[model samples]
Target: MSRGKHARRRANRNRATLEGEVAALTAQLVRERKRLDQARAGARRADTAQARLTAETAAAARVMAPVEAEATQTAAAVGPACTVLTEAARELARCDARLSRAAGRSADPARLRTALNTGVRAHLDSVHRSAPLEYHHAAFRRRRGVDTPLCRTLNVGGWIPPEIAGTDHDRIAAHMASRAGEHTRAALWCWAVPPWMGLPDGTDAPGRRTALGATTTGAPDLPDGEFGGRLRAGAVVGTPWRHRPLVALPEDAVDLAYWYRRSAWTQNWHPHTRPVPFWLGDEHAHGFPRSQPLPPGTDRRLPFPAVIVVFESGWQLPARHPDPPDTRAPTGLLYARGHGPTTPPLEQPLYRLAPGTRRDELATPLELVDRYGATVEGLIFTADPDGHPTDEFAWCLAIHHPWGLPLGRITIPASRRATHWTTAIDNTLAGVCLAHFHPTATSTGSPGADPSSANAEPHARDDADVHVLDIAATSPTTGSHRTPAHAAGRAAHLRRATWRYQPVGPGRQHRRWTWVRATIVGGRASSRSTVYRLTDT
Candidate 1:
């Protein structure tokens, strides 16, 4: 009975100890719940901050998008706009200088005006003198004894009735040819209306109306079988208004007459009309043929002889005045078409050799003649037998001889780099023509030689190195490898020949000639060609 009572007392003490331990565990669980709640609040704040950062970054990108695009657009327009601005500034400076000079020369306003007018008239006369014969005579009114109906009517104060003038271009051209001595003058008068509005407004010092009665004279008739000084089968003819040359074809008298008649009637000064169709195009096939194609059965022929002109298509003069005198510069020729940007005409003229002509005849001595009565003698350069960039070479070689000489390399005043290289060297005539010094000789090593070595000839000594002279080099003319091996072989057989330059007159100083000798070494063949021999007159 005593043992049972002791056991009950111990069991009660143990139950009390268990109740105290349970209370401590419950307090620890509540503190853990508070910690979890604090951690969740911190996580929510971090997420909100992260989302705000992301939204700010997106907003910043959207703000910069147009700015970046605007920067890109501004960069794109800066180049050409800068060029135009530079040109305009130069022209303005030039005009200011001219005005200052004129002001200094004359204090009286009337005298200044007269001086300026006189200067302009003299300048125009000089330009007319330098123009091509066809244009020069027309502009200056070269006087002859005989007169045509157009000239007679003008001289007698009888205006050309609209009926006689005729609206059709073809009929107007026929009327101009109707009279013996008025053809060129009639054409010139027609061209004067739109471009030269001052032609009919001229009056004498007496203020009489007799100015219209004075007729511009004419020149002797063109020799039969000739259009522009006997159009050579492969020769090129140049005009004052065009930067390109017309490829002379082997046309009969009928074709020559057709060209003369049409060209005489056409007023080149008109902006819209292509004055002469010297080039071939779709219009040639369906409307008016520029030249007769060779008969089908004829043997295949090679490219016609031409002067391949090479120049930077993007090159331009810093400033150009709208006077005829401005056309005297080779750079000015680039703007001959007008102030607008120029491109190759859709129908560029092409010339090829007659099948009967010998390949060796390509180097036949020829002359580079200009309307300004300047002539330089050299061998004729043929077009690439395969095809050429007719446009590039046409402008490249069409630097009128009247502008200047030493044509190989030209450095314009105030320009940083030399802009021109007009020479008669074969396809290999690149950077060499643009070089500062004239090379005495050129040589090509072998066909398989490295092309980097190609430029070595123009810079290195001919004795120290052998650089490959591509029988055909990469140029505006033909492909790198298009020239035949036989062509190189033919160059190998060229005999050395030298010619003396004749003096202009006894009193005139004799001009020294500079020559470039080129040795082309092909497989099993080698030859020397006098590529360019320029007179420093």
Candidate 2:
């Protein structure tokens, strides 16, 4: 076409092309707007999800705190029973070692035998003093002037001693053999003194009869006083007989007076202490019959005293049952005579007094008043160094709190009586008040009065504090005229961002977040995010 025609045609074609380009651009713009809207919607949804997650995390944290605190407390209280068991095991091990050493040293058998014999003799003596027959027979002979030997034994290995000969010896030997073994017969020997006898030299005095009708003096054969008569003859017969160093009597006229005096003296003097009157019956006076059959429904009560004097070394007077009545006599002696000239005014008072007049009361004046008030009962007293009746020491005392908690122990000084009344009162009040006022938060397992049990808890409550964070995003972008510049423009055009988080519990859980700035190039998108989770204070 000519220059004019060509320019016009070109113009028309350019106009048409430009129009089409405009329409395409418009369509592209609309598409981009829709994508942006979609991205915005996605971002909103992400934000919503993150918010829900944050709420859930906070709720969980709230539930865990108290549980954690309880767990920590429980761990602290379970450590004492283990400690006691460990100590008990150590003590048992020590006792075993001592026993082993004693058993190993058996070389000096003679000395050991002597020691054992001495111990055995001591045990036998204790048995005799406690035996009922020893007391009853002694009483019977003194009253009737006739000796009825409980045991008739004179066997000495293959030889019979000259002192225990005749029909008496044979009867005694037969009776002893029936009760004990042949070796026992060989080891044992006996001598009988005619009525009104004395004990052998170095022998303990015979037990004295002290009741109202009991004999106090020697019979006709031996005129010297019963105890005095026994002191002179050194009677080895019925009184204080020894198994070793056999005694033989002359076959002819026996020295009846000599034996009588000896027996009397021996019966009067106690082996452990000076001569003292036997007041109470022997310990075995209340023994059960071995061979005799009892009627049905026999109610046997223990015959020994309930409270024995426990020495520091653990030896007790009358160590076993059937103890001699006069053994370990109290320093002060009081006789309970029938209503006669010797009886005291307080012996049987018509009305009970605040303090009973018995000389051997166990309780102290203060303990009786504080614990039991002023209701007076019969008292038992032990003598002081000077032989005066004194109050007894309260050995053990404990205080219980109102909630049954036992707080502490009160130790008293060694004395016959309590020094002051205030000590017991103060201890009881303080212990009870403290336990009642402050209910320990520690789970005391029981309401019983044991202070130790007042602070324990079961083991199931521990939790850790936590924080949460959730992030979500959606974006739409387009690239098409397809140049790097165009892509960059699209990337720059649309963007949505959201950050959400919550503390794990109602209390604030510390949290920190850092956002890393992003550098955009071309149409590509990138995000940089960081979160720092922390604990609750």
Best model per TM-score: 1
Instruction: Estimate, for each residue in 236-351, the C-alpha lDDT of model 2 and write its tens digit.
Output: 22212111111112210012222222323223312111111101011111110011222334222211111111111110111111323564211111111112122122212111
> Candidate 2: where are CA atoms >4 Å away?
78-537
lDDT of each: 0.29, 0.28
| lDDT for position 331 in model 1 | 44
**What is the per-residue lDDT of model 1 for residues 9-109, given as tens digits with 9 covering 90 to 100?**
89988988988888888898899999999999999999999999999687557556777898899889897999999998897777666656666744678
Task: Return the TM-score for each candidate structure.
Answer: 0.18, 0.17
What are the RMSDs of all candidates, in order?
28.8, 39.2
Model 1: CA > 4 A from native: 1-185, 188-240, 245-533
Among the numbered candidates, top lDDT falls to 1
Candidate 1 whole-model C-alpha lDDT, 0 to 1:
0.29
